[model samples]
Target: MEIRHNELIQMYPIGYVHNIFKEAIFDEKMYSSVSHIVLKEEFQDGLKDITDFSKIYVLFYFDRSEGYNLIQKRRYDGKIAGVFASRSPRRPNSIGLTLVELLEVKGNMLTVRGLDAIDGTPVLDIKPFIENDMAGDDLRSA
Candidate 1:
């Protein structure tokens, strides 16, 4: 299939992140803090058996991130790198992904830790973190 560069894709948020931090904070403290992923009432049934996994991947949208820099200095090392090489919120598509520890699941709310996303961040999806899953292996190796 030929992919169109100008094609647009639409997605509805399954939930939103809730935390103490109101703004983006690029620091260790932000990732270490606890956060909540509150799913919509209609999506509540999807949370069933989610607690079986200790860790999960939180895919969210950076709604507040306005623009992107194809090439920029790394936040931590200060070395230059491409946008795709670093975890900068500024990207062609302002999408953020973080692996957070699943602490608890109560009703439609999920208590998690190590989530760097700020409060009210729209959560795109959630997936279990399977360490042994080879699905993440390099495509060249396939």
Candidate 2:
């Protein structure tokens, strides 16, 4: 498939995140915090059977992030790495993927633990985290 570098793509948020965090904070507290993913009324029905999974992948948008650096020092370990290699919010697409623990599901709201996104953050999608689906070290060969 030929990729179009200038192509413009658009997406709508399926839900919004609710948490105590008002902005991005790089710390252990942010990753160990609890948050809620509230889906729109129209998308509420899609949560059926989702409770079967203990963990989920939350795809969100970094609405506040402006620009990105190609190479920078990592937050935790001062090791320098490329944008793709580091979990930086500032990126070309500003898309974030976090694997959070699913705590409870009530109505259109999902209580999750360890979501780094701040309150009112737009959620693009959510998917179950399957252990068998993890590529892990196998991805190095691919």
Candidate 3:
């Protein structure tokens, strides 16, 4: 499948992320920090029954990522690797996916831990994280 030259896809943000950290930093500090995913009033109904899950998968757009590099050196190890092999925000599409611990769900708002998205980041969608979503240890050796 291919998109035409003029073809375009559109997406609307259901909510924006709110967190204390302003800058995007790849570190272990986000593990304990809390973040709020405040959704629009119209989308509040979608949160029904979401609190039952312990974790959720958040799909968001990298609104702050400026450009892309197919081959770039990783920040931590300074090792050159393909863009697809690394989790660098600078990607072709600038999309981000992360599994976060769901602390609680309030009307139109979801309080979560371990969200790396910056404040005001657009949230595309959210889904409950299931065990099947992860691969087994045996598969890692394949």
Candidate 4:
């Protein structure tokens, strides 16, 4: 029960991600292939029509991770987690969510694919992962 530091936590990078995941460590068997994201040129008109949703929820900005260790150690087993239940990019606020799978948008760039982020990375927002809310079928359908 401790979260009170307001500046309302703002964000602005509407676009800047192009990946092949150049490298940031974490290739323990290529974690789900499919990769490509561009999104730039004046925000590419926000990629209108979002390709009728195939799946997308990028929200990036780990900006090359910097600090945090509120309890870590869970590569999948050494359990000592609790940095918000471990998705650990070593965070005190590095912000990096990924659910990519738009596949193509061409025009300012957006061909995303299962992003794990880390290749220019700065796409602070891009939602559209709603598929029946009210607790029915979300969690990306599962």
Candidate 5:
């Protein structure tokens, strides 16, 4: 079956990223990039009571990523795979996700760690990762 599409869905940035990652590539090493999520003044009220959580799920946009190839070389295996199978930044839609530690929340700025998104990237949304069934990965032994 052919899947038709619509453009009714849209997203706006709730904030902007602040980090040392000037370019999309990481420092000499592959995973040394670090960034912080700084929410806009208007969204400050939405972050109330979020400090109780330790980890936050960050949703961002890869604005710098212009276009993507369906199949690209995997950084690990050096093998070409579908974009869906790998974590390459290039995508039909430039949405990005990262689970980072909520180090500290001061006003509208949130200091986080373990995120790889570029600086000035648009932050779509932020969700706290609470310890609950929905946040579990439990499964029966295979």
Candidate 6:
């Protein structure tokens, strides 16, 4: 899991998210927001069979975050915590992940609900959401 210091890493977006959300929000509206994932024409074939899942994980970039702090106050509670402990967009890699409800798929586009990403966000990757990965019968309280 370790790479050489001189190694180079690169990634190209296969698609972009289209939505009405213009800013960061963590409200009830977010749960109802409908967004579209439009994949490049070349990647259209990748959408095949994706509709079988009810949910999928969206991996995207926090392209708008300016900089980051290792420690910060929680937005909802004003409590101090490490950035890693919080969901703030600012981060070491600026990558964001959200598990969203899959609604429908059309050609190279997918309609999904509950995607928190804003319009034009670059989608790094997508994965099927498997409930077995949650690890437990007893969930830990956040």
Best by lDDT: 2
Which residue runs of candidate 5 sit more than 4 Å off their true CA positions?
1-4, 28-34, 135-142
Judged by lDDT relative to the true structure, which candidate is superior, 4 or 6? 6
Which RMSD does model 4 reach against the true structure? 15.7
The TM-score that candidate 2 achieves is 0.90
lDDT of 5 by residue, 21-139 (tens): 77887454323445677888999999999998898889999999989999998776888899887777898788888788888888999988887787899999998776663544522
Task: Note the Cα lDDT for every prediction shown.
Answer: 0.90, 0.91, 0.89, 0.75, 0.82, 0.87
Instruction: Tell me the lDDT of candidate 2.
Output: 0.91
> Candidate 4, which ten residues in sequence have the lowest lDDT sum?
28-37
Each candidate's clash count? 0, 0, 0, 0, 0, 0
Candidate 5 TM-score, true structure as reference? 0.82
- For model 4, the stretches where C-alpha displacement exceeds 4 angstroms are 1-6, 12-32, 38-41, 45-69, 74-87, 97-105, 110-122, 125-142
lDDT of 2 at 138: 38
Which residue pairs show collisions in model 6?
Answer: none
On lDDT, the stronger of 2 and 5 is 2
- Model 1 pairs in collision: none
Q: Model 2 over residues 34-106: C-alpha lDDT tens digits?
A: 9999999999999999998999999999999999999988776879999988989999899999999999999
**Candidate 1: worst-modelled 10 consecutive residues by lDDT:** 133-142
Off by over 4 Å in 6: 1-3, 25-28, 134-142
RMSD of 3: 4.8
Per-prediction RMSD in angstroms? 3.3, 3.9, 4.8, 15.7, 4.8, 5.0
By TM-score, the best candidate is: 1
Q: Name the 10 consecutive residues with the lowest summed lDDT in model 5.
A: 133-142
TM-score for all models, in order of appearance: 0.91, 0.90, 0.85, 0.32, 0.82, 0.85
In model 4, what are the clashing residue pairs, if there are any? none
